[model samples]
Target: MTKSDFPALRMTIDGGRLVPAGPFDAERLNSYRRGTVVYVRFTEEKDRVLVRKWFAIIDIVLKQCQTPWKNRDQAHEAIKLALGIVNLSKTVGGDYMQYPKSITALEDPELQEALEQMTELLSRMTGVDVATLKKETAHIVEYEDHGPTTGEIIEHESGAASPDADEPPSSSSAGAAESPSSAAPTNTDTTETPVADLVSVETSGDGDAPTPSPGARDPETQRLIDFAKDVLPLAANTETTGSLLSAIEKEWAPEIKKMSADGQEKAKAISRSMRAIFNRQASLNGALDFFSDALGCSVEELGG
Candidate 1:
């Protein structure tokens, strides 16, 4: 529908976010119909002129992965990179919040599978070949010396480790193996390696994530990194967002403009949250002339 269909959510400028005001009831929970749009409003710094925009948490999360992941590893590379920046934003207590726990939790099969699904979906969504990162994962060497695949486990006993991954005729372990149909309990530990240990997005053989060319990335990219790290939390510095938008318009406008309506929206949604930060921060200066098509963040909010 239109903006009139959604309820209003007021977010105050605390420091670096647009936190909803109140005890976080139904209006703030976002558990209602997805169609229920929530428009955020901010009174101008000095003018008190009303500025409003839709604030969607799910949309923002989806936007971050739109950059066209190179693969699961590459996506996590970005995740690791982004996580480092987020951790840099410390509280007065001087402790880094363990954020985006995906880094540490990748070992969980469910998370790994979900991430893989996301990588594939996001790749197709952005039309960027991020799945190529699987090649880096393929290059890893695995050892089967720990235990046999869970399928080969014996009843009421842990799966035995194999000496070689390929040549596997352990004379002593012959009768211990059980058929898949066997109605016996099997061990938890098995040959299937943890995905996190098998493939690290944080490194490409050098044990470090990829780095942006200090001078090569556009000002928007640089500024976004700083903003995620909270270096510019108090101020979104919309000037930077405006510059990036101008650059995108100049370089990608014609091509992006020609894209399908859905494609155009996806492209525009790219890095919308970061733009919101700059826009919200710029509010401190009073009236703002610039706005991004990405996501909403016309004011900074800090939590207690």
Candidate 2:
């Protein structure tokens, strides 16, 4: 089943059927009165049961690792690390690929503490923060100068040709005091000269390129880009991504409804990020604006 079917619970395939995992304590599940024992029933062959169950565990752990933290950036890093760990485990078959065990192998005490840590972190990361994370992770641009200025090269060449020049340069010494006693008068003029050369070289090589000015991108635009790069990754799987967007909608929808036209405009920008799955664009926009404005910042600020 999709994340929409069960808002609170995280679902993964277990025994060839989807089963809820994560922070839904027994009390929370019992309150819903859904059923006493939550087990997955599959029609697949008996031999495949264990394999499917193991897959389910892997999925759940992978999903959990991607869950956001109080600091969205940190959470995103955590998720990437988690994904890497899971991917590594997949390379090695058997019980080592199981859920909580696989996650625990990372030796992260924070992850082991409680499943709610993921939800709490995501909630804490503001839009601006998410935006910042996105910008940081985006491709790096390099800046370069084409070549040295004409005057600089000329001066360099002139300096380098000094020793071979026809004209002899003047000396600064005048009315110098004579030595009281000298064994012999030396006629040799000793000069140590430094020279600069106009070497034909590519100052800006193929690898060196100028970075576009930050001003080229609007703050809002950059923030949006960042949100896509950073926050989206936290929602590693389809279910997590959907749930996160849903949570944003549910929590901020009411506030969004009360926003002004200008606020609405900002909301629209945020809606674009959720366009793929968020059906209620208007509502999502409003909700995003509300959250941003409520926090005395833009959506970019929160996502950053």
Candidate 3:
């Protein structure tokens, strides 16, 4: 069947089941067998509107800037690059090159983040504060249509969403997870493990012990600790160091959600520091050591 031949449905994840959220063609849904696979993308209507409106606003403002863009698609690609929202591919010569990553593929949390970064970029380029920028763009953005009311709960097929968001929609694409099946629900609480309880300092036994969870700490400190927990486990011996750095890079998206405007700038700085060691061997250990020096802790204390 052609792409347009498929029907779409709106649904949400409730108690690990896909519950219809709006009027759906029941006949189409019944055509598939129980084990038939489909694609799922989890994005919200509001997020889609925000992204398009921001892009339109940027396109308008760019006419007066040093680098003017007449083409909206090209402008969008440039914006993605300037904001570091890209994927890296190695060239035939073994050097890294950047290509624009799809903004639509971003999950709810990630989409909001890209909009924020786009706002900041537009602000700097236009020499305006966020409040004023919004005011100026409000009219232009309003000219665009807000996508489907009672629309399908869908995702970009790239990343996972937090537990609080809606479930993904089904598509006919193979190799993708079927909607609502094989999708595991995530926990909503962290209180089960006492913050003071000690987790292993390293995945390998050679490292130190009794690293306490930063429970009840201020949100900022706890945020970094949580990030370290997620990223540090990939570090083992020399063989596994690449996994560690890749983990750290992957954490960049969700990790910055809690950061303030100032904190975000500082994060970019720290990211640059991390990227400096990407070419070096033992980069994971170097990164952990760097974090320890910056945070005033030993390497052993770096993990969860």
Candidate 4:
């Protein structure tokens, strides 16, 4: 749902969540999402790494799929199709494909056409042509089939849970608890760059603020502050990225409200990534605002 559908705007948050007014339709949101709204508290430093990894994951996969139909490489093409099937699994239903081997379905003419269309749409939305992503991904070849289970991908990576799963959680339960996906997804690898380091609050003109005492310091909290300062400006300019994410957020409630249970679960995966990306930007913007004001400077000063 859009901001107007909720009682608060995207920026309006209370206790780290969107506080919708009264009598909202929780059915519109998937359950694994914890409650209704996405909870985005960066409780650990690794959470920031998870966000960057997710960003890299989406960006790298899209770039691999970008060439014209004839020029696409087989392995990269396979990876792209795998992602597409997984995407379908998220939006359409879990039953569409069971095993990760479902990537082989890309060979079917119908599936090929569908994936081509989806890849193109995602390409347009993410701008993942070679030039858009200049860096090389050396580990992609080695990182094959190393993600969560399909269910976990749907529940954890996808951001929202099923209707049944969400009912058990109180956060989406209208102020009883907090959304689970709000926390960053944990990573298997620790060396993945801590994006928080890149988003330094000190660079945001908070260099002069008094340092927290040793006893009060929480490294994760400080890292998150840095992450926000670094990401907000970039977030401002990513309209395509924003559009793609916005589409994902609205996928369940407005777009697939009439879909079947399986269909809805499948579709909610799309919302998962969308919410994850939005959380990164929203949290960063929130953090930058806090740091900027505290240091008596404009948010723009917080940069790489």
User: What lDDT does the true structure give each of the candidates?
Assistant: 0.32, 0.31, 0.47, 0.33
Best-matching candidate per TM-score: 3
Off by over 4 Å in 1: 1-79, 82-90, 93-102, 105-235, 238-257, 260-269, 272-304
Q: Count the backbone clashes (under 3 Å) in each candidate.
A: 9, 22, 5, 18
Name the runs in model 3 displaced over 4 angstroms: 1-9, 12-18, 22-47, 64-71, 91-95, 137-304
Residue 235 Cα positional deviation in candidate 4, in Å, after optimal superposition: 23
Q: Write the per-residue lDDT of candidate 1 for residues 1-304, one digit (tens) a residue.
A: 5534433433554689666454432364555577766554555321110100000111222222223333333333343332121222455897433333333333346444434433433333333343332322232223212223221212121234333322211222132112221113644543221222222223347433343353754444333333323323323443465666456445655655665553444344333333434443122112111111011122231110
Report the C-alpha lDDT of model 2 over 209-248, residue by residue, as the tens digit: 1222446644543443344333333333335556676676
**What does candidate 3's lDDT look like per residue over 55-125, in tens digits?**
54554444323223445555666666544566767889996655667887776687776776666545533
TM-score for each candidate, following the candidate numbering: 0.22, 0.18, 0.38, 0.17
| Residue runs of model 4 more than 4 Å from their true location after superposition | 1-109, 125-252, 255-304
Taking the tens digit of each residue's C-alpha lDDT, what string does model 4 give over 207-265?
A: 34334442454443333334334334445443537665454344425535654443343
Model 4 quality (TM-score) = 0.17
